[model samples]
Target: MARINVSQLKQACVDRGWLDRWLDDPATPVPMPMTPAGGIPVNGRLFHQLVAGLVQKLCVPDASAPLLALRSREQIWALLWDELAAAKVQALVRSQSAEAALHLAEALKAWCQRLAELRANCPNFKSWRSALLTHEFDLKRVAIQVSDGGVVEVSGRPDSVQVDPVHGIVVVDYKLSRGSNGTLDLLQLAIYARMLRLAKPGLNFAGLLEYYEPGLHLVPKTEAQLNAIFEHEVQPVLDRIAGHEKLMSKLKSVQVGHEAVRLSWQPKAEPDLGRDIEKAYNSFKVPVQVMGRVEAPQLVRYLIRPGLGISFAKLRSNAVNLKIQLGLHAEPLVMPGSGHVIFDVVKEKPDTVWWQDEVQRAELTAHASPLALALGVDINNRLILADLCDSNTAHALIGGSSGSGKSELLKSLVATLVKRNRPETLQLTLIDPKLLTFGGIVENAYLTGPILRDIEESLACLHLAVEDMERRYEILLAENHTRLGDRIAQGKTDLPFRVIIFDEFADLINSGREEKKEFERLTKRLSAKGRAAGVHLIIATQRPDKDVVTGQLKANLPMKICLRVTNAVNSQILLDEPGAEHLLGRGDFLSQTGSTPVRGQSLFIPQKEFLELFADKI
Candidate 1:
C-alpha cells in the first residue's frame, strides 16, 4: 500500500508497458520542459504563482468583483496585481528587476488580453456569469483495493470546479504553456472528475481544459469520456503499482537477449544490389539505369529508370532473367505502374522487427481509437495503421503460404490490440482452427469468449457478432446517432468494439456445405454493416483459393494483407492481381489499404515474452 496523488498515477501510466518503474520510485515526477516560445527561459515557480494569483482574482467568486465577468483590461490587471501583493505571492516577481520578472509581466499581460477576448467573444463565458465556481478544490485520501491484497490511498487538488447551466459539475484545469501533452492533460482532468463523482454520486461530473488562448479555446469532455479515461488509462496503472513485485519477478525471468529466433535484427550494410542490377541489365542489353534505392529491415528496393523509349513491359519480361542472374531465391518484383520500373529484392539476411521496440518508439497511447490496428513498419520506417473505423479498411482478408509468418502476424495483431486498448473498450473473439496460432493465449480481460477451436464454436462466435451488430444498430436508431462512437460520446460507455480474429479461415469454410453457407452469411452480413456497429473481422488463411475466399467475401473485404504465397495464382487470388508470390517470407507482407499495395515488415513478439507480459491476465 502507498499514498499517491493523481499526478503520480498519471506519470506511472505514461508508459503502460512499464508501470513497475513507478513502484520502484513513487515520489519522482515525470519531467517536462519549461521553455516558452521564441526560446525564452521560464521560472516554473513564478509562472505558477502569477497564474494562481490571476485565477484567484478573476475566476473565484468575490463580494467585490463579479465571477468570471469581464472588466476593463487595465482594471483587471490592477486588481490581479493588488491581490498578488496582498497575498505576498513571491519576492522574485514582486521585485520585477530581472529577465524572469519581465517574462512574468509579459505573461500576465497576455493572460489579461486573452481573458478579455474570451469574455467578449465566447458564448460559454457569457453563460458562466451566474455559474457557481470553486477554486483549489481539495480531494482527500481515498483508499482503493487492488488484486494483490493491497490498498492505494489516492489524493489530488484540482484547480477549479464549476457548475454551469449547460454542463453540470465540471472539473477544470488551466494550461498557460504553449506546448501541450494530450495524454497527461486528459489523464489529470479525468482523475479529478472521477474523484468528484466518487464524493458526490448524484452530481454528473465532466472534465474541461481551459487553456490560455484567444476567444477561450476550451476542450470539454463528456462524462462517459472521463469514465473511459479513468478505466483504460488510470486504473491499469494503479493495478500494476499494487502488484509490481509479481510482475517484476516475471520480467526478471524473461531473457531479453535470448535469440533462438531473433525478432529484432538490423544488417550492417545492404548487399551490392545496385551493381548486381547493372550486371543483370547488361547481360540482357536492356539499358536500364539504377536511379536510386531504399533499404528496409526485410527488403531493399532499387528504383530503375529504363533508357529512353524502353517500355515497362520490356523490363517486366526480363524479371525472371534478372532473378536468375542475381541468384535470388524469390522472384524479382516489378510492381504494376506506368512510372519508373521499381525492382524489389529481398535481403540476403533479412531483419526481424520486434513489437516491443516499435510500441515504445511510436509512443502510442491507450486513449487512441480502439479500432486502430498497428500493422508493422514500412520500408520508410513509418508506422502502418489500419483503422477499422474507416469503411475501406473495416474488414480484412490476410493470405499467406507456409513459412510466411501468417501465425506470427496473427499473434502480433492480437497482442498489440490488447496492449494498446482497455478491455472495456475493445473485445476479441479468437477462432483458431490450427490451435497452434493462438495456443499460448489464455483467459484474458480483453476476450469476448474463450479461444474457439472447433468449427461449430467458431461459427457460433460469428453468429453472435452478427446479432451484436444488429442490436447495436437498433441502439443507434433509437439514440438517433449514426455511429457507435457518437453514441458512446453520449455516455453509452458499455458498448465496446468487437474484433473477430479467425485463424485458418479456409479450414472453417472448407467444412460441410451447411456450415460453409452459414459462416459465409454471417461474415458477409457483419462485413457489410460492422464498421458502424463497432464490429470488425480479420480473416487469415494459408490456403488462398476460390473455395475459401469467395468473390462476394473479397468484395466486402477490400483491405488485404498478402505474404509469401505459393504462386502467382494464389497471389492474384488475394491481391486481385499478382506480386505477393515474390514477397520475402518471415513477416514480410504487402498491405493493400487502397488500390496499390505497400510492403512492410510485421512485428514479431516471442511467445515467452508475451506470456510474461500478460501473466496476470492469463
Candidate 2:
C-alpha cells in the first residue's frame, strides 16, 4: 500500500498540469514551481514546519525531552519562540531585504504570541496533551489507493493518534491558522484516518482537526463520517483525474498555426474540449474580423469519433492582440481557420414576447390574480411573477438608470395587469412627470384618471391616494373586516385594487423642501398602511441616492426592484446588495422581496406593439 502526502493530493487537485505532467512519465521528477520573487512575503511555511517539529518532539515518550519537561506555559512558549526566531533568520537571509526581514519577524512574533495565548486559554489543551502522551500513532507520511484507480501520496503525520479504550483510534492534526477550519484540512484528516484503517485492520478510526489559534478549535469526526465524506467528496475528484489522464493520453499532436491552431487526437477518442475553449475565449472579448473573401472565425468543425480533433485558428491573432491591448495576461487562443468550410450557423435568438403578442395576453388572462404582477421573463424564459399580496410586494420601490429598461418594465406591469383583470377588479393611477412614459396607456379603462404630467398634480394624486387609503381603512373598520381581501372574500364590498405608479419618483421628492416633505409623508403613509386596504404603490426613480430614496421610504417599501444602477452605492440603496451595478442593462433587474435578490430580464415591449395592444381602447 504505497502512500502519498496530503499536500501532494491538494496540489494535484488544484493544478491540472501537475497530474498531466506526472501521468506522462511517472518516473520523471517535476520540481514544483516556487512563488515568483518579491511576491507577498509569508512565514506560514516556516511556522507550520516549526509547529510540526515541536509536536513530534513533544510526542516522544522520554520525560527528559526539552518541550515536554517545560514547567510553565511561558517556558514552552519561549522554547517555541527560539525555534521560530531561528527559522525566521534563515528566511530573512534568503529574502535579503531588511524590510522583508522586519515584516517576517513581526509576523512570526505575532504567531508565537497567538500560540502562547492559545496554550494558556484553551480548556482542551490538557486533553490534547494527554492524548499525545498516551498514544503511539504512525509517522506523518502515509499513502492510500483511491477507489477509482490511482495511489496518492499524502504527507504529514497526524499530531496524535490514540487507540482509545472506547472511541476507537482517534487521530488529531494540529492547525496553526486563525480562522474557521477549512474543508481541505478536514478532508486531509479524513484521509489520514482512512490510511490508518488500511494499515491496521479491525480498528475503528476517528479524525480530529485541532486549530490552535484565537482559541483551541477542535473538530471530531467518526470513521463512518470520514468515510462518507471521502466517498462523496474525494471520489469524484479521483474520477475526474482519471478521465483527464485518459483524454490527454489520446492527444496525437497540437499544431500551432499563424491563423489557427489545430488539435489532432488518437483514433476513437471524444474529449469534451468545448468548455476549455469557451473558458479561453471568455478571458478576453475580441471581435470576429474576416480576412478577404472569408467569413468571420466561428466554430467551424467538430469531430466526435476516430479520435476527435477541433481546428480553430481564424481569430486567434486578433484575440491575442486584444488581450495585449487590454493589458491582460493572454491565454492560448484557437479559432477557425480561413481554409475551413464556413457553415451558415443560425444563432438562436431570445424569444421576444411583445406586449401585443397573443401568447402574453393568454398568459395574463389565464387564472390572473389582482395580487400577482408579472414582471417579465427570466433568463430561463420562465415568467417572473411577484405576488403583491403574499410576497409583501404591495408597495415596491424601483430604481434604474436611463436605457436600463425602467420605463419598459413599468409599461409591461401596467399592460399585464390591465390585460389580466377587468377595470372593476383593478384600477391604476399613473404619475409620469416626464409625460412621455405612461401617455400611451392613459386611455386604458384601468386608469383611475388621466396620467398626471406635472409635479404638483403628482403630489395631489398622492394626497388623494392617502385619502382613499383612509376611506378604505374606515370602511374595513366599519364592516368588521381586517383586510380588503377578507372583505371581498366575504362579499362585503366590490372595491378594486388601486395601484398608484409614480414614474421618476425623484422628481416629486427633489422638487422643493416643502414638496419633498409632503411627498415623503404621503409615500410613507401609503407604503405602510395601504397594503391591507388594497392600495399599492409602484414608484420608479432613475436617481437612487440617499437623498432621494431615503431610509424612511426604503424601510416602508419592502419590495425593491433595481435595474442597472450607476454604482454599488446605488445598488445598495435599492436592493441592499452590490449586484445591480453589474446588471447587463436594457431590461436586466434585481428584484428583492425579502433578503435574497432574484435577477430577471424585464419583458421588452416596443412602443408600436404597446399602442397596437391598446389600439381598440385608445
Error (Å) of candidate 2 at residue 327 is 12
Residues 92-162 of candidate 2: C-alpha lDDT, one tens digit per residue: 76766665555555544454453454345444444335534333345454445554465544455555665
Model 2 TM-score, 2 decimals = 0.46
Choose the strongest candidate by TM-score. Answer: 1
Looking at candidate 2, what is the lDDT of residue 618?
Answer: 44
414, model 2: CA deviation in Å? Answer: 0.1
Candidate 1: tens digits of C-alpha lDDT, residues 1-618: 467788677765554211322455464445454464455444545555665666655544443436444555666667677767334335555554356555555566666664565455444554333343566767887776564567677898887776644566688876655454577889888888887877777887888886643223578899999999887567755654555545445556878786463224465586768877977887787888887888888888888888887777778889999888888876788874324577888875568788887776422342235566778877666556666775657898999999999988888888877776677778888888768888877888778878899887888788888889999999889988878866665666688878899889887788888888888888889998998899899999998988888888888786899998988888888887888888888989988875457688898999997766557764
Worst 10 residues of 2 by lDDT: 298-307
Q: How large an RMSD does model 2 have?
A: 16.4
TM-scores for every candidate against the unseen true structure:
0.57, 0.46
